[model samples]
Target chain A: MSGIFNSSIGRKFAMALSALFLMFFLLQHFAINILSVFSPDAFNEASHFMGTFWAVQYILQPILIFGVIFHFVMGFILELKNNKARQISYAKNNGSANSSWMSRNMIWSGLAILAFMVLHFIDFWIPEMNTKYVLGDMSGMHNGEFRYFHELVEKFHSPIRVGAYVIAFVFLALHLLHGFSSAFQSIGANNKYTKSLQGFAKIYAIGIPLGFIFIALYHHLTGH
Target chain B: MNLTLKIWRQKNASDKGKMVDYQISDVSPDMSFLEMLDVLNDQIITKGEEPVAFDHDCREGICGMCSLYINGEAHGPDRGVTTCQLHMRKFKDGDTIYIEPFRAKAFPVIKDLVVDRSAFDRIQHAGGFISVNTSGNTQDANAIPIAKEAADTAMDAATCIGCGACVATCKNSSAMLFVGAKVSQYALLPQGQVEATDRVLNMVKQMDEEGFGNCTNTGACEVECPKGISLENIARMNSEYLKASLKG
Candidate 1:
């Protein structure tokens, strides 16, 4: 509701919900991308299905884009408001005495992830959109073969691209390290199960990003 | 103990504050942090200079009147104690202590080391009480058969003394912990159930209106709270607010 979006807690709840969506999307994206390392045919078939599927293209894609945009815009707004809350800076502050570095620097890490997202869209989504929508090429074919896996491999062939991805994934790790548990806390999910949940959050945060890094490194090192 | 004090001094609410350094000697280890400040004030009085102005009343740690950001830690580097209860033994001889007021737009500096915490008062005034029809029909406190665990949790939340340490220590200057405690103190009780929805909605509205930041769950507030108010109160408030908004 409009009222929900109007309040501070409501905005945070929305932010946490969007973060959860994006994190889920990241997991699936990693799952699909990692397929290129293990089985290129499977990766191509999966990517082709996702690209051409009517339900995914029409329904989920728009929602995913909205979620991403909402997360970023809301994050910037909250950061600005939070900055205004403390008009006078502390003469001395020992933030690390009680909180972690990742927790304190979420905005910086979030911005890093945003920068990588721009590059990622440029390298993949924009071209895919141009090919599928602009050129009206629904076939998902090039050179009489499935182009998804080949395009992914071709993109990673650039050392610069691979290096950029590696750095982005590192920032992704840092962002998720604080963000995963933080989202749950924002939603008031803190309870006895919170300890185990935080443990799981840590694994998912570190593991998923590391998986993406490995996939990128595998493709870059394999020279394929 | 001989010590160097770098204390923030401002003439009034409108004055630009600056850190003025002073050297004091023969500070007894047994003296509380406030007592040591009293010693420094005596010295300033003897020299016909304006003494530092800070907030303190009970000096026994329960009043929550005293607030100081000492050496970058709220209540001067001690855990579970206010500035009034912080002992001089926590510091070494020849230590240079930096003291400043709790910095937040909602909590502006009123004078040297004193901030106007009336923002907390405003938030409290919003919904920090349960409605009682006091027409010579006061009910017995025990008439409401409250569960012991809930009562204990409510008591823990009630232990919060409206200290600004949480706001001072929070990176975002979020007052969520303070507002959470106030909300939870009522939300966890049968007597408080009637107005629970309005309490959370109004208090949170006032808190945001007062320019407190949104909580990031960094949890510095819980660590620095003199009463050791848990972060669970915040979670409770979030859930309460969510339920209230959805119900409406």
Candidate 2:
């Protein structure tokens, strides 16, 4: 495993696997969040269901947390190794004029996304989980349902909190645009299939985050 | 046609470089870009000032040595030719052109528009060769039948003049195109298979060690390349590097 980490191919494979895992997690998270647009009552009920589920809280959440941590740590470590390798004879001319901005800024963008994730978990996930699990307070009623529906709506009412969510979603989109296609290429998926994958990844990269942002904006604008 | 030139001037690598203005009146519109520079140099010598120094071994478009960053574009405004082949007719009279040497952390200006490109040569020396020996009575050259498509691609990859245009146009100063060409040239040929893994790994290692930036696949190098080298070579190199990494 150490040898694989040291090798160029090993690092790429690690990146691909981690990226795919993260993408799956993103889809799951997006699906749950999208429910807010249809009905806050339904969303809170769904959130309550998820918050109370023993399997998700005990088994899947830990695995998801591990995946996120592993992906972040490995991405940084690989980038550092590549940077160290390129530091020799630093006076050579950079003759490549045709690379992209996003490709070069991956590390910085990744750091931004990582910081956003920490804030995100603390802002919502912790409170949602804690109120349901620890305090056992699932208050408020809307449309004949006893759920934390009011709390969910009340949180987005704050302009500062909504702005933070919007900003973090932007960073997430930027990360996904580059990360999606890069992951596929790293895994030797460079063919006709690769083009469609890149296109789909690009759409998802924009669509999912925008979907989350719209929900926050819609709630804030409607005075919910 | 007359044009004003703002060319970079420096005594040597140790001296500070700056842009110096020069005016040439009544220049012919048909003169090639280098020929216009030559006319300016002659006037500079008549005024007892040192002539501008730039690299241009082949007047034709083949030798990759004629590197010029003209008006913020590599090899001037033209799409698929070197500075030596760029015609003055592309510019109108009374135009102000800013000419500078290709600037990168790895490529230091030696004098005027000339930069020390020995770094590229050094990276090549790291492992840009096959390990075959030239013993007498070797196997027939035609013994191995390579596909026509592969042969054509190899020829295209072999066209890289090592001119550093890719670096000049790249936002990250990545040498992925040049390095890719070198790696693909060998990876496509059976003669290069015996030591393919070592060759790619060493070359990539040397490339990174030289302080060039990472490839972002922006396709700018392809646009600026005098020979019009494709980014497919880069994709090929990435694949080769990945495969080689797995073997170890």
Candidate 3:
């Protein structure tokens, strides 16, 4: 309903929904990207299918973009409103005594991830779009071969880029460390199952980003 | 114990406050923090200077009237105790203690170490009640059997003393724990179900209007709460609000 997004709870609920959506997308993205390490042919096959498939390209991609944008915009708005709610901060706040550093610094971590997203989009998504939509080349091919694996390898050849990526993934881990379980709490899922869910959240939070870092390093060290 | 006190001094609502330092000696370790402040105020009175003003009632801690941010921790360094209940033994001899009011836009300072928390009263006024028939008809207390678990949970939610420690300690100054406890105290009971929808919807509306921040589930409020109100109450309120909104 229209009124649902107006209240604090409603706004948080919306944020949680978008967060869960984006989390799912990240998992699938990681799944595909990991293929570049194990099997470049399979990676290219998955990448080409993902790129060229009409349903994924037309339907899911737009929703994914919207989810990302919505999450960021809403997060910014909440952060601004929350800052204003204090007006004047405590003379000396001992936030670490009660809350985790990651919990308190979600915005900074999120900003780091946002910066990474911009680089990621520029490095991969924009060029993919240009090749597929702008240049009218939906074939996922360049010079009679699939370009996905070669382009992926080419992108990882730079140590600076890899370093930036590794740092970004670290930030992503911090973000998810708080965010994954936090999204569940926001949606009112706190119960007997919450403990196990937190266990799973810890694994996903550390593991997924670690997995992404492994993929990036694997390509960078091996491809060279 | 000899202590140097840095207490916030503000004349009135419009006055900009500053921390004013005073030295006090022979403070008994058994004395409560408020009692220590009383000793300091007595020292100022003897010096022919105006004494510092802070809110307190029933010094035993149940009234929730006492609020002091001491040494960067709400209710001082003690866990699970109100400022009135915080004993001086926690601090070392010759300690320099800093005392300030609970900081939040919703809880603006009224005087030295006193903040106006009527914003909470306003939110309470919105829906923190249930309608019961009383004209020649009243339900017996034991007429409706409540599940033991539900009753115990509701009692836990009800134990919140409405202290602003949660807000003061929160990085965002969120009052979700307070509002969530209020909502859960009702939502968990069968008597509260009839008007549950409107109660949650209206309370949340009033809560936002009070300029309080949203919960990020940092778990800070729970840690700082004297009564140990759980984060589960907040999740309960979230689910309640969601169900109410979607029902429309």
- Tell me the spans in candidate 3 whose CA falls farther than 4 Å from its real position: none
Q: After TM-score superposition, what is the CA distance of residue A88 in candidate 1 from its true location, in Å?
A: 1.1
Minimal lDDT window, size 10, model 1 chain B: B128-137
Q: Per-residue lDDT for B1-248 in model 1, tens only?
A: 99999999999999988999999999999999999999999999999999999999999999899999999989989899999999999999999999999999999998999999999999999999988888899998899899999999999999999989999999889999999999999999999999998899999999989999989989899999999999999999999999999886
Best by TM-score: 3
DockQ score of the complex predicted as candidate 3: 0.82
**Can you give the lDDT of residue A208 in candidate 2?**
91
Of the candidates numbered 1 and 2, which has the greater lDDT value? 1
Compose the digit string of candidate 1's lDDT tens values, residues A74-123: 99999999999898887788888889888899999999999999999999
Scored on chain A only, each candidate's TM-score is: 0.98, 0.86, 0.98
lDDT tens digits, residues B1-248, model 3? 99998889999999987988899999999999999889988989999998999999988879999999988888988899999999999999989888999999999999999899999999889999899889877978689999999999999999998988988888888899999999999999998999999999999999999999988989999998988999999999999999998885
Predicted chain B of candidate 1, TM-score versus the true chain B: 0.99
Decide which is better by TM-score, 2 or 3. Answer: 3
Every model's TM-score on chain B: 0.99, 0.97, 0.98
State the DockQ of every prediction: 0.77, 0.23, 0.82
Stretches > 4 Å off in candidate 1? none
